[model samples]
Target: MGRPPCCDKVGVKKGPWTPEEDIILVSYIQEHGPGNWRSVPTNTGLLRCSKSCRLRWTNYLRPGIKRGNFTPHEEGMIIHLQALLGNRWAAIASYLPQRTDNDIKNYWNTHLKKRMKKFQTALDSSLVSNSSSSSQLLSKSQNDMNSTSLRSCSTYASSTENISKLLEGWMKASPKATTLKKDQEKEKPSNENTNVVGTASSQFTQTKVEEGECGVISHEELENFFSFENLNSMAWEKSSTDSTPQGSLSSLNDRFGTMTEVKERSSNRPAYCFSDKWILDEESGQVEDLMDLSLDCCSAPIF
Candidate 1:
């Protein structure tokens, strides 16, 4: 169907309004206060249609109209408000106060639209670059940590190995160290059984507090022995159950998995390690020792 005409076309003048027509329309609106478009031209003695007169007055001839190029601030406002309200130019115009809906709509089409396209393109490119840089930084950090951990692990392994060799040499040299000392009395010779752990001789750093009894280990001996012994037991226990490279890798992954899981479940986890009675390590039959610092160090401070 042919669309109905916007106005009666018989006696109406269409297209760009003249200065005289602008004066007439302005004069009529100022006198009557605008509305009733269909009769404005008739009442004002203008030769334009009601629609043209309305458009002219609303778009151009209205009082307090600020015509010409839009300011940068105005253009920005249009783009921002447009994202929320879209092409409801009349609604957008209401906020600007001095701007008209038709004028704003034309400015958008002629100028801001093209500028926005370029602006959006630059914004997207910047976002992509930021995303790529973030990924690279994360990957680099992980690689650096892996390299550090491997280095520290190798150093620890070397230290423990040297301690092991030293321990074996000391043991072989002291076979007679576990000897039974005889207790002598004035009346009769008595034999009392006493088993000493070791009697590292004069070359081996030992001291006896009293006659016929072994003294406790020195601070130096305990420190050196505990350092290697504790770590050795932990590594051995983990490796014994793990059995293969794949199992070890899986266990490492599980450690991280458990950490993230605990972080996500912060409400359920204990505030302090000492507060918890037991912490089960993945499907294990026996509870791990509290002194196993490896588990707690990794588990806490995840957040």
Candidate 2:
């Protein structure tokens, strides 16, 4: 049999910590610095066990610990690290300066993991379809752009202008915790209203040879850029939480008057289709799903 447990439960205080206890723990650590856990309660005059004291301090009361939502870049990093390190929270926390091991663990369990399980079936089909047809789909987007005129629509924003603006918006906007329509309308930057729809000479046209140009878009490149595809064989589940992808995709065929297609299918939901022209009349805002949808880049309000 194992040795007796470290502390007796008979008189030990338990449950949520009190303000007085928190103050005592803080004072002791500040006075003498954090050392052995077994000594914290003895020296600090608190009723919590050493283990409890240590956990409380490390996970909650620790200085500089950021308690809030994780940013997209940070979320991407966490997903990448977790893939590499498994569930090693401490190892994962090292890369995130302000987050604790407990915090990252909790976030993974409560938010991302559950969503991945929910969408596993749909993602299996989307992943295969998208990975194989990336080039063809993009070529179609280019052809459509050439044949179509610049049009603006919202409810079904399939026009070339709408696609460009929406793609640009995702590239430029900050990652939000909420995707509600009202909040997004208020948050959209007014300066971004410049029409991105134009010929190959359009400012949005991208070139790899140019310094600022992102060149063409590719899932292979994005897979590498994201650096965490395995997701423990749940690789099917991409970045669903904190859906902020870095940089932006430039049409690889920008030199050929082409624009790239947005993956309409997210692990979260069905994707929207973007082609050169809208099926609707010039002024109509309603969108009809076109042929061959892939990933869904959060576009302008499709209300």
Candidate 3:
């Protein structure tokens, strides 16, 4: 009955090998130098069959064995070698020294086989399409060829127009461009104050440029544009006007503009003064004021 197996299947272990078992196997092979699998189980007292022990050593436990995904060159070599060697995986493994026969066989069946099938189908489809198109082209007359060329040109022009319109619409509707436009509009007045500074810098830069057309720019004038004094003034203005605790809502609303509009609106608002009303209790002979003294935008006190 199949030569009664190698090490008796009754007590032999199956499935994946453990790290400890792998270490034991590797250590024994390092000392003994592989081969003679029949005595390996007996000598090491391992629960594996002789065949299992041999496979574990050759496939995994081997010192120079490489793991992980195969490279493109390795894949191509496997495919070509398989074609030449057929299903002789041991022969293929001999060429790829780092890979085991089992690994090559498994990879071929799982990955390479499907890839080759897809390649073959794709090649067949391309050939069929080429043949049909070529036949149609050959059968077409000179007039039909001219008409086809004219139609293609028209379609290409139409496509170009559509693409141009789409690009124009995209540019106009772009959020970044819209935001930049709004920011530019908002900063127009602020920038107006900076234009005098920019003009002076520009004139100085132009004079420097005229003096040394090929030389490096002097950075002295540019430094003045970003001077600490200018930066301090800008910071002070922003902090005092924009972030001031005493500033009214109108001041906050007109932050982008000069404070003139805020001052004007505040001055035009009518002053308000609230008075207290008293209730007389005839039975108790007492008078109670029901309202609190209040004033809004009024210089005079309300009592």
Which residue runs of candidate 2 sit more than 4 Å off their true CA positions? 127-303
Candidate achieving higher TM-score, 1 or 2: 2
Per-candidate alpha-carbon RMSD to the true structure = 40.1, 19.8, 39.7
Ranking by lDDT: 3, 2, 1
lDDT of 1 by residue, 243-284 (tens): 232332233234333334434434332221210101111112
TM-score: model 2 vs. ground truth:
0.45
| Best-to-worst TM-score order | 2, 3, 1
Count of clashes, each model = 0, 12, 0
lDDT of 2: 0.43
Which digits, one per residue and each the tens of the lDDT, describe model 2 over residues 231-298?
Answer: 23323323332322211111122222232222221122111111111111111221112111112331
Could you give candidate 3's per-residue lDDT for residues 1-303 as a string of tens digits? Answer: 467766567888988777667667655765565689988998998999989999876666653444545654456455444543346577566546566788778777766565554444443454566443322332332233234223322233343334334434543666754564464344322322223222222332233233332132124532442233332233223223422222322222333232343343333221110000000010112111100111111111111
Segments in model 3 whose C-alpha atoms lie over 4 Å from true places: 131-303
Cα error, residue 32 of model 1, in Å, equals 2.0
- On lDDT, the leading prediction is 3
